[model samples]
Target: MYDLTGFQRDLLYVIAGMDDPHGLALKEKLDQYYESEIHHGRLYPNLDTLVEKGLVEKGTKDQRTNIYRITNRGQREIEARRGWENQYLDESATPT
Candidate 1:
């Protein structure tokens, strides 16, 4: 997670939520979340980054589409991030 860029983090979250997330599906979901069109130039490279980092595992869904899944490392990273975020959120809400 510390090694992950913002785009890679988003990709991890998206992959975790989906069963067999492919490029197009990932792009669509990201576009909706980002409220902008996700171009091929941006999406694929970030996905590759996740694969390189061992946070995501890639596989072919059929003859064409390549699917992605979050690995155990990815899950641990997500949990770590959530815990880090909770510390800030909790402190922010506490009376000064």
Candidate 2:
């Protein structure tokens, strides 16, 4: 997880937060958050990286779409990341 870039980390969190999201769906969520376009050349390769790392599983939903889901290892990594974050953040901080 620490070896991943911020964009990769964001991808992991998005996959974990949503139901099995296909590539375009993932792109849409990222666009909504970034308020800008994300190129396929950039997106697909990074997703492939996550796949190679065993943190995410990629499966086909249809001929035209690929769905992504976080692995158990991915979930554990997320929990670990949250725990690490909580250590530095004040517990009483207001939401947003």
Candidate 3:
């Protein structure tokens, strides 16, 4: 949660938003969101970090593909983060 880097947090959100996203799919989503290319060396290692932290699980989809999903721990963290954010943000707050 608080220990995760911003990029890793973004990764978690993207993974949560998608259905069993793989490396390339995650990369594409990030690229579109960031409007720039994401390097493999950067993406996979962070994913491995999430797996090691037990916030995410990695599973094989095929000979050449791997899928990712957030664990229950990860979901709890997301909820906690939302709650923490809501503490300072009014529910009806709108963009200027």
Candidate 4:
């Protein structure tokens, strides 16, 4: 997790929140969050990085669509990251 870029970490969080989201679905969510288009060249390669790191698992949904889900390791990483953040943030503090 520490080795991941901020964009990759953002991708991981989005993946954690959604249920078996496809690449385009993840892109849509991120595009909304970023208030801009998330190009495929940027999206897919980062997704592949997460897959390679064993944090995300990719599976085929059908002929053309592939779905992504956070692996157990990914969930653990998220929990750890939250704990680390909590140490420095007040309980009432909210990200903007």
Winning candidate number (TM-score): 1
* TM-scores, one per candidate: 0.95, 0.91, 0.92, 0.92
The local lDDT score (0 to 100) that residue 34 gets in candidate 2 is 82
lDDT of 1: 0.92
Q: Which scores greater on lDDT, model 3 or model 4?
A: 4
Better of 1 and 4 by lDDT: 4
lDDT of 1 by residue, 1-96 (tens): 877778888889999999978999999999999999999999998998988888899999899989999999889989999999999999999999
lDDT of 2 at 28: 93
The regions of model 2 sitting more than 4 angstroms off are 91-96
The superposed Cα distance between candidate 2 and the true structure at residue 17, in angstroms, equals 0.9
> Per-residue lDDT tens digits of candidate 2, residues 34-87?
899988987899999999999999999889889999999999999999998997
Point out the higher-scoring one by lDDT: 2 or 3.
Answer: 3
- Reference-based lDDT, residue 51, model 2: 96
Q: lDDT score, residue 89, model 2? A: 87
